[model samples]
Target: MSAPGEKVTIARKQKKLTQTELGDNVGTSRDIIGKYERDETKPSIEVAAKIADVLDCSLDYLIKDINPEDELAKKIEQLSPINKEYVMAVIEAFEAKEKLQGKR
Candidate 1:
């Protein structure tokens, strides 16, 4: 297993879900979510599985040393064609912005 907290935080944010929102979906509280993100506490496997589902990621992504890009590609592959196009446009815009700032 890798740094679970970091993976949870990244996957949660990638889904554009607030900790509170994620907690609500997972039948937990925002404080618990915060604790998980800060690594102050660990969620049970069941809770972790729920978190993964709500975040649209897999337990493997959260608990193993998996490449994040692969997880994201998997999610993107499941999107509708129009939604995929939107994602590509967003990626292009972000890349363009990064280029303008000499970040890439």
Candidate 2:
């Protein structure tokens, strides 16, 4: 498990977000984002929460090595009923197509 800084960097990259973009989302500057990534500075709880929100991740994932995908699933679980139904339909369609192609 990596530290928060490494987690931040990983999540940011996974989301294909630039440091400037992430900082902008969190109401900070690119330099501050760099400092956080380098572990030279720690963000306050509010800032951390904002970062997590922008990154579509949980604070646990950011600070405690929890699986980020699990956090993503949690977010999906919170989707509106119609969106959830659409997502499930897409998943079922993909699965059916895969089965037809003999792919797991």
Candidate 3:
């Protein structure tokens, strides 16, 4: 896995956030965000936790070499309840399709 800064860059981009936007949400300046993204400076654990929350990712993904998707449940936690059910249904449909193909 890359450094926490790389993970931050990836996740921030995935969220379609600019450094300034992320900084605004994370309570920092854009320059600080840039420093973090460039790996010139690391955020404190408290700031990192805030960043993770703003990015809708896990602190483990940022600091401990864990994948952000490892917290899949957290990823979908922001979805509406009905949307969450729809997501589950879609996963079930794909699994069922895979099973059918295997059986064939």
Candidate 4:
């Protein structure tokens, strides 16, 4: 499994954010962000949380050894109430269809 720092680096890059930009958002310096990316240093829990916020990812995703589906669930958790309901409904529909087709 990748380390928390590595997860942060990957998520930041996937979001198209530079180290400097991420640092600016997280109230840190580019050098510090670079260090984190290089796995030479670890951020404080608060700073890590801020980084996750800036990267639009869950803290679990950055720090825990979870699968991609867990990450997707985390993303869905951030949706608005109505959107959350809609997404859940869609997922349930798909699951029901799959069950009917003996695909599960």
Candidate 5:
């Protein structure tokens, strides 16, 4: 497990949440979250629980130093449509632009 401070910072970043977003959910200022992330301050147990709940992560995972982004990515993938046409369109546009430049 990482030191408590490192764990918190890593969890926050893995959630892709800004300090301001986290603080908004946890009823604190972003500065407080920043301080926690920087190891300049520590949250009480109650605050830690709140943080875990708001971040939608298990306290054990947060404390035990698991990589949270994998779960987050899975959740995002579940929510997002697999739009092959959209992806292919973007790729085709990029190739067309490249060819146009070659012609110049």
Candidate 6:
């Protein structure tokens, strides 16, 4: 619980949500959310679950000590070349669609 504050802060920032916004999503007040971020208080299991859902992060990520970016980078690096090409193709298709729409 002591260590979770920093990591939770990081996750919340990455999601670009303010304490008030996050609290709104979890049905809590900004003050309580601030306490969680400051490590002054630990959230109940239910509140934690709601926070995880609102933040689009795993409960483990908010509670346990883990470097989320490291794991994400590793997973991204593991994508196959063919899969990478497919992703690029999708991006190109979207760009083409946008250009076509803009010309209309």
Where does candidate 3 stray beyond 4 Å?
67-104
Candidate 4 deviant stretches above 4 angstroms = 70-104
Q: What CA RMSD would you report for each candidate?
A: 5.9, 5.2, 7.1, 6.9, 7.9, 6.3
- Give the count of colliding residue pairs in each prediction: 0, 0, 0, 0, 0, 0
Estimate the TM-score for candidate 5.
0.54
**lDDT of all predictions, in order shown?**
0.91, 0.92, 0.90, 0.92, 0.77, 0.85
lDDT of 5: 0.77
lDDT, candidate 1, 1-104, per-residue tens: 45889888988888988999999999999999999999999999999999989998888878888776887899999999999999999999999999999999
TM-score of 3: 0.65
Q: What is residue 72's positional error in candidate 2, in angstroms? A: 12
In the range 1-104, model 3's lDDT, one tens digit per residue, is 68878889999999999999999998999999999988999999999999999999878878886655756778799889999999999989999999989953
- Between candidates 3 and 5, the lDDT winner: 3
Model 6, residue 52: C-alpha shift (Å): 0.9
lDDT (10s digit) by residue, model 2, range 8-93: 99899999999999999999999999999999999999999999999998887787866667866998899999999998899899
- Whole-model alpha-carbon lDDT for candidate 6: 0.85
Candidate 3 vs candidate 5: the TM-score winner is: 3
- Alpha-carbon deviation at 85 in model 1, angstroms: 21
- Global lDDT of model 1: 0.91
lDDT of 4 by residue, 9-80 (tens): 899999999999999999999999999988899899999999989999898888888888876888999999
